[model samples]
Target: MAARRKPALICCGAALAAAVVLAAVFTALYFTVLRPRPPRVTATVVGTRVSAFALIPSPALNLTFDVAVAAYNPNRAAFEYGEVVTVVRYHGDAVGEAVVPRGEVGARASAEVRAVVEVDAVEVFSSPYFPLEGIAGALPFETATTVAGKAVVLGVLKIRASSVVTCGVTVYPLRKETTSPQCTSTVHVG
Candidate 1:
């Protein structure tokens, strides 16, 4: 009876050891290969159209801008954004703003968001440099866009991410034209 019990004990021990080894191997694979990764998103300033711009009589501007932004997601997940806020600034002061509706970008895909920003009665006199630049036909302006959202991976994992893009552009009020925008962006994920 003792000999039979000894053999059974060895068999049970061997089975336990094999189970532990398999678990360890699986954990290593999950961390190194199968684990979910954070998604990469990028934003760019596509184009801008100026409807009205002025700097005469009362140092006020009444302009409407058609702003387009592109959002790209380079991951195997879908990025669903809550809201997008865009603000137009001159000399660090906000002159116009627009809120875009929530949307989603598919995995390894891109989406474009278009917003119409209307500047009504913007006080151009707030900045002393405005007059100098306005007279030279090259008024500098900035547009900042903030997007906050979450990435859903395999319909199970949710990762939070956000991006902010700021662009600089020069506008010629007399000619009703705008220079190509130069943009930079920051992205965060958790």
Candidate 2:
């Protein structure tokens, strides 16, 4: 009976060792390759259109801005996002807002979103710094874009994620052009 028990004990030990090794390998792979990553977002000012500008009766300006937004997913999952919201600000006050329709980005792929922001005449003229900047031959504006969505992995696991990108741009109303934008971006996942 002792001899028979020896072989059984050896077999059980070998099985246990194999199980531990397999678990370790799988854990390492999940952390290094299968883990989900946050998507990268960026925005740029593509074009500017100044329709009306006057300071005679009062300060009034009507401007239309064309913006290009890009999103890149680095994971092996598809990212489906809700509407993209973009707000334009002058001296920390919101002057314009635009919305892009909801969309999806494939795994390891990128998408470009276009938005047309219309500036309110009242909001632009309300800023005290507007006169100074206007006289300086350039107007400064800030654009903030927020994207919220979820990443679907293997059509089963869904991870919520969001990204925000803010850009500072200088516009020459007379020239109908915008300078290179300075931008910052952040992403969150849960």
Predicted model with the maximum lDDT: 2
**What Cα-based lDDT does every candidate model obtain?**
0.74, 0.86
What TM-score would you give candidate 1 relative to the actual structure? 0.75
Q: Candidates' TM-scores?
A: 0.75, 0.84
- Please, what's the RMSD in Å of model 1? 3.4
TM-score for predicted model 2 compared with the true structure: 0.84
lDDT of candidate model 1 versus the reference = 0.74
Please provide, for model 1 over 1-190, each residue's C-alpha lDDT reduced to its tens digit, 9 standing for 90 to 100.
Answer: 9999999999999999999999999789656644544444444445555555565565555566666767777656777887788888888888889999999988878888887777544445567787788778777878888888887765766778888888888878778777888888888877
Cα lDDT, model 2, residue 82: 97
Q: Write down the worst ten-residue block by lDDT for model 2.
A: 51-60
Best by TM-score: 2
Backbone clashes per model, in order? 0, 0
Alpha-carbon runs more than 4 Å astray in model 1: 1-40, 54-56, 154-156
